[model samples]
Target chain A: MKATHIQLAHGNGGRLMRELLETLVFPALGCREAFTDASPLASDKRIPLMASDSFTVQPLEFPGGNIGSLAVHGTLNDLAVSGAEPAALTLNLIIEEGFALDTLRRLLESAGAAARAAGVPIIGGDTKVVPRGQGSGLVIASTGLGWRDAGCALDIRSVQPGDAVLVSGPLGDHGASVLMAREAFGLSSGLQSDASCVLELAHAVRDLPGLRFMRDPTRGGLASVLHEILQASGCGCELNEAVIPLRPEVSGVCQLLGFNPLQLACEGRIVAIVAVESANEVLARWQALPEGQSATRIGHLTVDRRVILRTPLGGQRYLDELAEDPLPRIC
Target chain B: MKATHIQLAHGNGGRLMRELLETLVFPALGCREAFTDASPLASDKRIPLMASDSFTVQPLEFPGGNIGSLAVHGTLNDLAVSGAEPAALTLNLIIEEGFALDTLRRLLESAGAAARAAGVPIIGGDTKVVPRGQGSGLVIASTGLGWRDAGCALDIRSVQPGDAVLVSGPLGDHGASVLMAREAFGLSSGLQSDASCVLELAHAVRDLPGLRFMRDPTRGGLASVLHEILQASGCGCELNEAVIPLRPEVSGVCQLLGFNPLQLACEGRIVAIVAVESANEVLARWQALPEGQSATRIGHLTVDRRVILRTPLGGQRYLDELAEDPLPRIC
Candidate 1:
């Protein structure tokens, strides 16, 4: 008989755990052979880049994606934005006892597919089961190993006073999509989370000689990324609010819930800094990708160390660092 | 006012999260500079090894070590046993909302100390917070990156019928200590978890000409490791029960609780297989280390496909794969 749900024994590192991994995990994740404690990685000549992230989104299954695919993309994007080509990924799963085995299978398969799509292999991983009630269904922590391009030099210190600020696409779609999935406010929208790998968008701009740095606007959205730039580069940003791309559905949710669209998350977007001379080229390359159809230059770095937004009505307002929790587990 | 417990806003990746990381995490973990999402690793000429594990032990703190230290040792040991020198580590923390801030600080500091002791730097990491009542206070996942020794060629397939099996130290101290810490059975003992880095022990014998393989007996302990060898090498094991290292305190706990000492966990022990000609040198080298004072040859590989234990009374019994979990979250 097959176990319908996870058991404590399944994490005991005994027969049951072996059975669970061999029958479900290995097959779902496309593991070709039984893994030892640690696996050896192929040698790479280029400098190595490593990034790790833990995914704890509520309602494990959200619109457009689940925690599985989100985990892969989140970690991969960190490397992607750092001007590195992802080499491999390691997954760590913390499962709650009594969680449905079928659900676990689906998530693993989804993660496998996402990795395959991105051309990275899931080389090694570990799993543990906590007693029921001590955990929320599951949490996945993924670490990505990548190889940086030999000639690429990207850093926040390179940002200058007149550098342009650009975004790969519309912001806040992911935050809005997850909010509607919760159904806490009885709101509905056709919005889907823009949770995806930003590898292509990053690769497109990585070779640009004038590129300063690129960051994925995730948890705290565009506002957070802007604040980070102010702190790291000693350069503030002046945004043209009218030109910043945003979806109508995402803006509607923010208006109704008293949330700032700029403070909402967008998993599939990139905030990049580049010299004014090369800004148009960066925009052109990004716009060529389907994921970046809405790419736009929304702002520019300023001499003053304060993030200021110019409203369409010619009103100027300072954008402070995000100070409150708009949504928990938005990632 | 200082917050005494974690809040959802601390994970929002905004002001609160930045403060939490800067004021607590960075200083405690010896991070000299603010970290970007992904950190570049120095290139290593040798083959790289990767391993990952999640620690979900109950009680958070045990008799001899806390989850933080355990997390470091567990992942590093995996790499060490694979004949790799630890290079770097990545930490992932999943904190429950309302978890005590002081506790978090202590764990991070302990983890930092452990990493420092092992001479491994934490290059990158991530943190996420879950809603209250949805997590068991804290769970830590660690991933280790290592460089394999150039001449080391360790694999289970290297074992043959004449290979001798040796254990570095007594078994079950970790399991017994954690079990007693729970106080579920109102039992007490002086047992302390033997949790520490096994790098020196592994290094001492990793280059032995006849060394077949090495494994750290963790979750399913000695019995499970032997079973794995049997399955992978297509060779069984013949163990002499009288010579196996068993601490009196651990044996007492197992006897009173109807547990099998051979099947309980040990955090800092190694089980090695070597050609009979090299077994004495391996045991001698290991016994010189404080962590391996009780090192002894316990068994030898057999032609038959069965794990047979020779009893002190001249009777023999088959050691079957562990089916039931004696204790959950023992690691």
Candidate 2:
């Protein structure tokens, strides 16, 4: 029996999952080569960063993107956020048996296109065929390697209070997209999941020595990332409610689902803590790109480690440490 | 409820898994420092290499070294085999809910002491509390990183037709010991798993330039490794059954279990592919070490990619691929 939605069958390494990846994920991820454990033994310094992560989202496919594109974007974002010049990545797929092949192919194609546009290669990866009713549809672990020189060292400690906080694009796009894609509460949204590669922005200003730190807001949304920086650098942040970017549809969907837009995850967005001297230039550069056109200055770091969010009516409140597993397995 | 053996409950990331690590794994590995995220950002010109893996043998604790020792040795071997100077490791525990905390502590103590004796520090790691009955009693992922020079690289392709093979010690000790421990096929011999860190021997000779290739006989066993090398280097292997080290009990256990000792996974042994001229010197070095007292020269390489086994009765037979998980997750 085909999995109606998220279930143990999706994650298991079986025929069901194979059909899912073959039909959904492999297509979205755009895997050109057949899956094999014996990948080509070659890596260049341009793609010196090799990172692997496994995704188990609550809902299989979400709005603006499914688990397929999310996996690709997640891996790409890791490379981009790290300041490395991403070259290529290896994808390992573990799927529950009986997943539809069409679904898997569509997802893989989407991911492949995304990767191609990002100018990164998906050279090699492995796909495990699991049993039915084991996994939901798929659980992907992609390991990416990118190249970076000593000059790319991002200092978390460099996040200074008063230094402007900027997100590459709108917040809550991916998060709201997930809720809408799930079709929960009989609701849907036109908002797109902000899942794309930041390679263009990264290379556009590879010479930007002032870019102190950059991180992708995936699980736990923009709030979680900012919180991490605050704790790491012993700093605080206060957002200007009016300036924070949010899609109209995202806001609507969040309201319908009783979810916090600030807490939703994003795949394509980048949160950069830069030196005050060049924040505007970085923002301008980001805004010039298609993926970064919606970039906005969300807030400013403070001397304290507390996080504060200002309401539309000028009310200020603290954003506490994120409750774990936000949107449970939204990665 | 003690879960002396692993159950689906161990992987739940709960109390039971904790006890296994705290009592069984940690103490066995001998880790000193509290686990953390990153292995202390490597110092100097050290090119850090980290490897993480999970072992789920049928039985909880095996003969010579249980899950605890294998976790440490496996990671250490990964770095060692890669020619990286041993430094430290971090232990990540994913245990089920009902596991005994006492067992967890005991494991941690053993892991700690082992790390100390091996001259490596146990840095910080992660512990996830999973839901009940979802996972096995314990699933451990140990990440180890060490320093290797820029020019230091071990290429499997470096193997020549005349290259010699050096077995660190006996081949089937670990596999046989696990079977004995697990009572696989209704049999048990008082055999102990040869699970120990190859660092002492690895450190004693990693600086030597002629070591062409290295691999820990895990998962797939000695034959698989030979097959891998042959395929990669376009070479073949000639094994003299008499020359290859095999414990009497290991042979007995394999014969009874309808298994081949060559295909069984091993934990402690290091299979070094080296030049014929340097093979003697390398074996001498291994023999001098306490862990390598039984070290021996096993065989030599050939141009063909096929593996040929010569039996004790002077009959020649081809060693084929293994079709089953002989010893499920022996690490």
Candidate 3:
């Protein structure tokens, strides 16, 4: 028989769920704790960081990814930005009745591989089945626990004028791909999800002496992230649109959707701040990776506490926080 | 002005949710780490026994309980059964759109107070707003981490056939109350919910060397607890139905609903096993507490490998594992 696809049955504590975990996910994630109720996390000598997030994207499965990989990536990113080495994660699934088993398996396969790439193990997890109509498709919640290398935390409040802002990859790819699959505004495009792990990028450059701050732009998008940093760091920021990287296709989608590219969500990307002298070193390290070839210097910290955007026509205007929700039900 | 009921605004990050936690819960459970994104737990000589549970009962507030108290009790019991000393807990709320602010505040107050009463603190928590059609009132997920005390464990595998079965307080109260509220199975009795914290009761019997196992009957009711013990210990059970304690009103509700009292749920009660020599002492300790006043000698463990019920008719019948879904969404 061929693969049956993911269903609620695969989540049940039966043969199907067992086989899926053992065959696909276990090898990728080191398979030690994925089946347990929870990963045993103990704080060692270093300060530990833990974060929990829930993914509620619609359609369960989407182009360039499904809910599974996104769940792993979303959580790993949270831990990475906090300057911690993600140790283990707990994946809990709330599956609606009658969900296809084959789809679930494929999602788990991708999720496990993503966790492995991030150098973290998917330890303990739980599965609960809700009756049909009570819940739709599936809702996945992942909680991550990581250890912060002592004295290596980047202070978000310590960012100062003349600090350089950097992006590890192009922006808006994730949101664009999701909208393409969702058929929102009657638009369809062949865009894949950019859901990949970023633990390596975080670890590789984490030890930089001049590093000031870092964050993963998820909900509220890049524009919101910038605004948050300004407000939090008590500093101003200025961006050069020409230098900021964006996929041509993503730009097109944003234009038609009347959405700002910077306000569009990105699943697997990083924004780092560093001293001007170390900016070249950090950029070099990021661009060396396959996922971060487009890493660019997008902006610079300003003494004035305002966010200014350089328009395509070389005009300058303050870019305020987006007043509207860009996307809901996003991981 | 008269007090208003629960409104959707309460679950918002604004005033209602804050007042609920600040006024009701924080005062009782303490203020530290209550508002943080995650509750940080520390340990020394004692190992933490972590457990989590979700409650989705239909009515937000029941006769003798509400979702708040249930979340606290459910989590503490999980730790208790593992023979751990209850320490701290995290409470996560998934509030549906339009949930009343007043109602949520009241519920949190109750939940917070309940945790304090159990000597447990509501540490970390999360809140999400789902669309109206997506949820029923609200769902609460509580994760509790407890410290294990020396000589406080009851390993099921070591249980022997001569061990005796006992129960602290009555069964069927919570289950009967749910039926009365649901108005299902032609039952509309005004039975009260038996939701209560069992931490004290669990601790009282922790030092009993004869303690073999303990469990609280909730979803599948009292019968399922017995089944779990029998399976884990590889022993049979013989239950004396005549001696199994039940409230008169709860028994009436069960009869009207065409359900057996033995198959009903009990949130605050416990099913315990001990060596016969210590059974009387354990029972006496249980009877002294107000919550354990209705405790009884419910059954015994046997090598027969079959669960049997001794009926009031002087006849014997199989006490099969409860297969019928007695009640749904009872945490």
Candidate 4:
């Protein structure tokens, strides 16, 4: 009889572990190499870039994506935003013993599909199982290797006064959707998480000569990314609140929950800084893509080192870095 | 006034997370980059090699090392045994909310020390916090990028019948020592884990003209590595029980627990297959290193596809791939 749940033996690095990898892991990840210590990465001439992230989203599976897809997108997005084309990825799964095998398979398949869609292969991986109660159902850590395009330079230091700020899509959907899924507040929403690869959004503006920097607003959302920009460039940001895209469902939940949408996570959104001269071109390119249909120019860099939001009422408010934990394990 | 334990806020990608990284993680890991989405890998001409591993060792701290050091050694050793020179590493830390910050500091410092000792830089990383009870103290997933040696052509396909099998040091110390630390069975011992980088041993034999393959006998110990070799090369291993190196403490623990030392884990050891003519040369080189003083020729590859163990009494028994879990999270 096949075990329906993971056992301690499945991580013993013996027959069961081998069987698990060969039967489920390898096939799901599209890996052809038999178990080996390490894999040889294809040699490339472009400068190499690297990024890593860990996904601990609660409930494992959310509306539009699960921890597996989030893990892939999260790491790959980091590389993408850095103006690099992802070349390969390495995954590490820490599974809790007694977790359902069916669920594990589903997550692995999602991860594989995400990687395939991104055109990046997961070439190496490791699996370890913890005692049942010692771990959440599962946590995936991913590392991405990419090749930086020649002649492209993206750095926070490049941001100067008057640089424009743009976002790829709606904010707070991921965080709000996850919170809704948890049902801690007895609220339900039709909103789906925006967890997805932002590679296309990145590629759309990567060649813009006036592009200064790009970042994916994740855990701490757009507000946090703006704070990073302020710290890095010694410049302030002035945002038009009415222009920042936010879904009605997300805003409704945030208002009820007293959470700031700007401070909430957006797994699939990109916040970019471009010179005023090239902002329209960047916006046009992004708005043409399905992932960036709602892309908008939200604000611009200021000489002063403060993040300010121009409300619809014509009042200005300082946007501070997030301090409290609004929701845990949203991504 | 200060929280001595980790909080969910520390992983929120906000002020708390920034302070945590600046005050604890960055300094401990010798990271200087202020939080960027990704890092740039130094361009190199050598072929890149990638490997990843997660460490969930129980007790968090064991006799010779903690999870932090173990994570570094485990991932680096994977690359080393694959004939790659250590280069850079990425770390993903998943801390249980309420875990002691002091303990986390010690582990991070140990990880930094290990990387420094191995001359590898941890260039990129991420941190996530899980709800307290949903996690063991902490789990570290590390991915390593390395440069393969210029002329090294190591692969299992090169292994042939009559090849000499060698081990760099005693087996099961890591697993037994961790078991002792757990004190789950009220048993104690002075055994210390042999968890360290095997790069020196790998480098010593990598240039040999007849070297067929090299592997780190880690999670499944020497026996499992032999099984992998058997499966990959269509060859079997014939080991002389008396000739294999074993520590008295480890053997004592295994005997008391009815565990096969051969099936236990070794955090830092090498199992290599070399041409019979070059075995003595490889042994000499390994024995010269302090880490490999106990290096021994434990076995030879056999044409018959059956792993056999020759006992001191001139009788033999088949050493099957491990089927049961003797311990969990030893690595």
DockQ for all models: 0.82, 0.10, 0.19, 0.84
- lDDT for residue A105 in candidate 1, whole number 0-100: 95
Residue range A1-331, candidate 3, lDDT tens digits = 1334444434433334445456644654456633422223444566555556666676567777788889888878877877877777666666666666666666777787888777776666555545556665667666666667668748778888999999999887887787777766676667776767777788779999989888887655677677777766778899998888888889998887787778777888998888999999999998888887889998899988888988789899887665534454555
Q: Model 1: DockQ against the native? A: 0.82
Question: Which candidate do you rate higher for lDDT, 1 or 2?
Answer: 1
Task: Give Cα distance to truth, residue A53, candidate 3, Å.
Answer: 1.9
The segments of candidate 4 whose C-alpha lies over 4 angstroms from its true place after superposition are: B184-186
Query: For every model in order, what is the number of clashing pairs?
Result: 0, 128, 21, 0
Model number with the top DockQ: 4
How far residue A94's Cα lies from its native spot in candidate 2, in Å, is: 5.6
In angstroms and one decimal each, the interface RMSD of every candidate reads 1.1, 8.0, 5.1, 1.0
Which docking class does model 1 fall in? high
Cα displacement (angstroms), candidate 3, residue A19, comes to 14
| TM, every model | 0.98, 0.76, 0.82, 0.98
Q: Give a tens-digit lDDT track for model 4, residues A1-331.
A: 2888999889889999999898888888777776467887778678887899999999799999999999999999999999999999999989999989889989999999999999999998888989889999999999998989667779988899999999989998999999899877778767999999999999888988899999999989998899888887799999999998999999999888899999999989899999999999998999999999999999999998899999999999998889979798988
**Counting only residues 3 or more apart in sequence or on different chains, how many pairs clash (N, Cα, C under 3 Å) in candidate 2?**
128
**Candidate 3 per-residue C-alpha lDDT over B276-315 given as tens digits, one digit per residue, 9 for 90 to 100:** 9999988998888888888888888899888789989978
* Cα-lDDT of candidate 4: 0.89
Every candidate's chain B TM-score: 0.98, 0.87, 0.89, 0.97
Residue B251 shift from truth in candidate 2, angstroms? 2.5
